[model samples]
Target chain A: MLFALRVAFRYLTANRVQSGLLIGGVALSVIVFVFMTALIRGLALFLTVQTTGQIAHVEMEPPRRIAEVMGPDARFAAQPISTFQRQQIRNWQLMVDQAEQLDHVVAVVPEVNGNGFLVRGTAVAPIALQGIDPSQIDAIIPLSKSIIDGSADLSTGGLLIGAELAEDLGLRAGVPVILRSDRGIERLIPVTGIFRIGLSNVDRRVAYLSIAVARPLLALPNGVTSVSIKLDDPALAPLIAEQLKRQLPLKVTAWQEKNRNLETALESQGRTGNFIQAFALIAIMISIASALLLTSVRRRGEIGIMRSFGISRGFVASVFVFQGVIIGLAGSLIGSALGYRLCLFLSEGITGPDGGPLLPIAPAEGGYVLVIVLTVVGSAISAILPAQAAARLDPVEAIQQ
Target chain B: MTLLKAEGITKSFRTGDIDTLVLKGVNLVLEPGEMVALSGPSGSGKSTLLNILGLLMQPSDGALSFMDKPMSGLTDKQLSAIRNTHYGFVFQFHHLLPDFTAMENVAFPAAAPAGGISAEIRDRAKMLLGRVDLTDRIDFAAMRLSGGQKQRVAIARALMNKPELVLADEPTGSLDRENSARVMALLREINHEDRTSFLISTHDPEIAKCCDRQINVVDGRIA
Candidate 1:
């Protein structure tokens, strides 16, 4: 093998220009592979972070309760289900503890969720009220960072409303507004803060309050309505949601289930990335194979002489194979380094109007080891045809020619 | 025991729908430590017979043996191994690997099989190069050498494995008269010193006379 490698190296070095050009071609293809991989992965990551940042990775709510019909007689079986009864998680703290014990669970915040109307001076607007611990105001939706008025202090019966809701109801910091819950309960709460999260649903229709103030107002004096879970990796939401469902009797929902369009877009992007990567590999392989085949043909007489001296066909074939390996190894190494540098350069220099990287190219996610291995293995496989051609050359016929 | 033997060897090539017999049924024997020449005109089958005897080509029908071991039953790999270990070849064009140095070319047959050019292989190549009077040119690239020097390197390469028989197919045919004489002298000196056999295939009568004896081929038959 060493002898074949030596021969292969010598053959490549003998024609420096040709070998250089071939290696450069392969390197260019590898650059394409690495760039596309990093870009797609980076885009997916950015989208996931942007979406999951404003929502709970997993949510648990009380299951529906249907009253069963009980009959003392054989033919009497009519039951009426009440519609005014509130559905609330009675033991939400226990469910929160169980969810917190699960792997990847970073934060679990129990909430008193309800629908109400924010009214101020005859300007009434519907709002989704989310009641949580004021200390963990940023546990799920990062409401603290998005606060544009007053403070996130929801203690002393204060409410945190969205900017659009405040605008609609003519409310602002340290102002009192009337909140009427669906349970027919009413309270005059002072607005503690106004937050704008850039999402229409959150900025226009949602309000935050302290869980203590919300329990009495929503008619849930001791139990919360739901539990919102945050995780270290949002992608693990579905798996954690399944485990949570099995561990508790609550209805568990992963964020992905609620945002099917995002998942679909990400999947389609990944498939497109795979196609581009495949084409890059194919181009590299075809270039190497065709170039090495030409080399085989050019050195026919030398190969014939080697065979005449009783060199094994395997040895001859391995020379070409080793050449492919050398070229692939060199090109991929150069390309990976360049690709990473290019990503870093682009990320640092290219910015959008918001001062963030325009493309969100993650240099660290370029799949360096994977691309190198694939290029090298693919190059070796591509060389097989030319290697076989060189190995099968008739020494007598070749020498005579 | 005979070093090599061939009985009723025949070879034919087919073009389109026609088959042309290149070698008729022929018999020959080569003893150890003997130099012989195969002299024939163009299309006289000398090169074909040499290729068959050297194990580079298989005869259509033949019974061949080396050191009394039957050759017909062996696989291609086995035949290649036998050739690498027991036979050597010097071609008309020198056929040196142009990218390699003289020493590398000399050590190729042995080094390639052993996986690398070891210290021992290197020393043997140097010694062979010295024997061919190319010691000063051992490190020179094959292409950089003169025709005579290249042919000398070729002769040294053939002796790299210390084979019992060296097949020279018009080995000095492409060289000038002076270089040809020098190459022939080197071959003769090696044969005499190592007790190695030589089978020189040539069209030059003068070159044939330099060998111990000559076997002429006419119309694919030994004459």
Candidate 2:
């Protein structure tokens, strides 16, 4: 083995130009593979963070109540219940405590959400009212960071409205507006803040208020309408929701269920990246195979001489294989390091309009180890045909040639 | 025991649809330390016979043996081992591995089989190179040597394994008179010093006259 390795290295170094070109070709393929992988994964992560950062990872709510026939012989028809009282979670504090104790659950916020109209001197606009504890104002959405005017202070019976809603109602900070609840109850609340969160729905139709003031207006004094959960990793939302459903009797929903389009886009992007990466690997294999085959042909006379003097066919084949391994190993290492540096440069050296990374490429996610292993193994495999060809060469025919 | 024995040896080649017989039935014997020459015309099967005796080609029919052991049913791998351990070959062209140094080429036959060039293998290679009068050129690349030096290196490489039989198929064919005589003298000296058997095939009568005895082939059979 040492003898064969030495011969292989000598052959490669003897034709330095050819070996350099072959390794460079393999390296370029590896770079493409790494870059595509990093870009696709980074884009997926960026989109996910952008979407999930403004919404709760999971939402736990009261189960829907449908009236069913009680008699044994009666037909089992599901009927909708039209009740005067709104459905609410009466023991929300218990669920909140349970959620907060679970792994990956960062925050468990109990809130009363309802629809209402904000009127300022007859300029009325509809709003989705979210009532939460003042201390948990930025638990899910980071409202404090998004606040464009005034402060995200919902204490002292003040209301926080979105920029669009405030504009529509012609209201500002310290201005009194009459908010009429969907249940016909109304209150004159002072607008304390206005925020713009980039989401059209949230910025135009959502309003925030303290839970202490919202309980009476919405007529849910002792219960919360829903419990919203924030998890450290949004990808685990569905798993956590499943666990929660198994443990609790409430309706648990993950954000993925609510945003199917984003999931589809990410899956499609991943598949495209796989195709690109596969092509890169195939390109690497083809290049290595052809170059090694050429080398074998060029060294036919020398191989014949070796064989004539009793060198085994196995030795000849192993020499070619070692050449492939060396080229693959060198190429992958160089390409991986170069790809990582390129990604880092693109991510850190360039900025987007919003001062974020321009390309959303994650240098850390380039799959370095995986690419290196694949390229080296693929290169070795690719050399097998040429190795066999060289090994099978008849000494008489080769010498005659 | 005879170093090599051939009985009714026959060889044929298939050219598309027809077979051409290259070697006909012939009987021959080689002793342990005899230097025999195979002399023949261009169309004669002298090279084919040499190739068959060296285990580089298989006889189409009949039996061959080395030291009374039959070569009939052995695998290619077994045949290769026998050739490596018991026989060496010097070709018409000095087919030295061009990228390797003279020392490396000399060490190859033994090194490849033993997995590497140990200190003993290296010393033996150096001794062989020195015996071939290429002591100063041992570190030079094979391609950098002159015709005579490369042939000498080839001779040293053939003796690297200390084989009992060294087959030379026109070993000095491509060299000038001076280099050819030098290479042949080196071969004769090694044959005398180590008592290594020689089966050299050549078309030159002068080269044949230098051997202990000469076998002449006219057609496919020995004349």
Model 2 Cα shift for residue A258 (angstroms): 3.1
Sum up the clashes in candidate 2. 0
- Tell me the docking grade of candidate 2: high
lDDT for each residue of candidate 1 in A159-234, tens digit (9 for 90 to 100): 9988988888777899988999877888998999999999998899998999888888788898888899999999
Where does candidate 2 stray beyond 4 Å? A68-85, A120-124, A166-175
Give the per-residue lDDT digits (tens) of candidate 1, residues B70-123: 999788789889989999999999999999999999999999999999999999
lDDT, candidate 2, A47-128, per-residue tens? 9999999999999999987543354444554644344346899999899998888999999999999999988775788889
Pairs with backbone N, CA or C atoms under 3 Å apart (clashes), candidate 2: none
Lowest-sum lDDT 10-residue window in model 2 chain A? A68-77
Tens digits of per-residue lDDT for model 2 on B16-84?
999999899978999999999999999799999998998889999989999899998898799889988
Per-residue error (Å), model 1, residue A102: 5.4
